[model samples]
Target: MNAQFDIRSDSTQISFEASDNAQLSRLLDEIARNEALPAPAPENVFVGDGDYRAIGLEYLGHFVHIGGLKPTHRVLDIGCGIGRMAVPLTQFLDPKTGTYEGVDPVNEGIEWCVQNIASAHPNFRFCRLDVAHELYNPGGTMAGDQVALPFAGNSFDFIAMVSVATHLPAKEITAYAREVMRLLAPGGRLFLTAFLVDAEDLSRPTARPRFIKGEEDGTWIADPAAPLGAIGFDNGVVQDILKRSGLDIQRVSFGHWRGIGSTHYQDIIIAVKPE
Candidate 1:
């Protein structure tokens, strides 16, 4: 568990590979430089300063431009890594009647977000949830951040997982589904993406693509029908979990189903809590 940084504690031990050593060092320096020197104040962390912020900013633009969110809509983003998505989205919220809540397991990510999220958006709220899971853990199971979040039932109008649940195995995914439903108000919508193969498809997959060879391998190449422990997924399995969680199927769109298998597929979906 030795990367380069001495980041470890009684409760947890996390480390990056030597490959990431330089990146981590650079991040520390960047924070120090920005913090000490202080630039002229746009203070818009997502766009104002760092390279990583652009990743978050692009997602924010898509959520509004593609996802069709109104500035006044209450938005809750799960697995909101850093302030990339959260920082900019916070700006769109009316902050008085509208609410924007973002959660992530990383302490530093949340700290950066808290310190930089605009003051203009008074209603913007972001919190660290140890119960948050790593976006992509081994076997594609989601890891819960170290702490549980505090929220009452049926509290949100809309919630999104983006690529969050895509990495979760069955149990965690089911657990998260229940939590999301519990937090969603009546008629609220949830947008999530996953690698499930559905019975709705009377036809099997048309093809399966080979794993990207060597260093070029990408997550988009994941084969959902691979195997039990493989990072892939299946619809039959997912549907059972959804039923147990009391969620009815709504709509699903498929992506990444190339290659040569009947089970290779990915989907972005929208679902609602039962009335």
Candidate 2:
């Protein structure tokens, strides 16, 4: 391969165009081969292989349909555990103009993505943040609220954080919202999934209160014994945080976590930076 075509070795950091049928065929074949391979061990990945594929495809479709993800978009996947979303996106995003960058706290998931997804798809990359979460990374040094991501300001066109916010405390959620706003290119969109709780929703007789109130009124925790087991926040407070961060809410779709019989299990929020 010539200098212009040399993207396989450090493909995790590079992007290339599949300008011809042969190149396109090769790309498709690589994706198919990867899809056939078994996912990382379930214990390490936190989700079953079959479930990963199903949820990944579902999230990808939602990103396309609801978030307006385009072939040319530069995407950032927060909490990209074990390449769940990255697997399906390999076939959707165009190699020439599209890119995927995934960041996660767990080393196992990041390692798997770097070895498999990033190696095969040059336009896709993964990074491990080593962020400290009592449940996920007990030994981590960095805190999600304080750590800055490796990306430049105003860079990504689309950002997705599926189930990520559900695991973050209120302060971390605010910090991430601010960081995401800073990293979003003008007009860029963000898609996030969480267990949203409004005042009325919380008051409902059927409400099970997955997360009990933490020290902060805005924060909630699933396990009082383990504060980081699962986290949630007041939906109104989160919405206010995003608005304060300069992101306009484009859509809000509640999910079945509230027993409302929605398409997904978590509520989805789509926010966009102003053009």
Whole-model alpha-carbon lDDT for candidate 1: 0.53
| Pairs in clash, predicted candidate 2 | none
lDDT of 2: 0.76
Compute each candidate's TM-score over C-alphas.
0.59, 0.82
lDDT of model 1, residue 160: 74
Against the reference, the lDDT scores of all candidates come to 0.53, 0.76
On TM-score, the leading prediction is: 2
What is candidate 1's lDDT per residue for 148-261, written digit by digit as tens?
A: 346788888778776665555566667777787778777777767665543333244553333221122222224444322223355555555665767666666565553323
- Number of clashes recorded per candidate: 22, 0
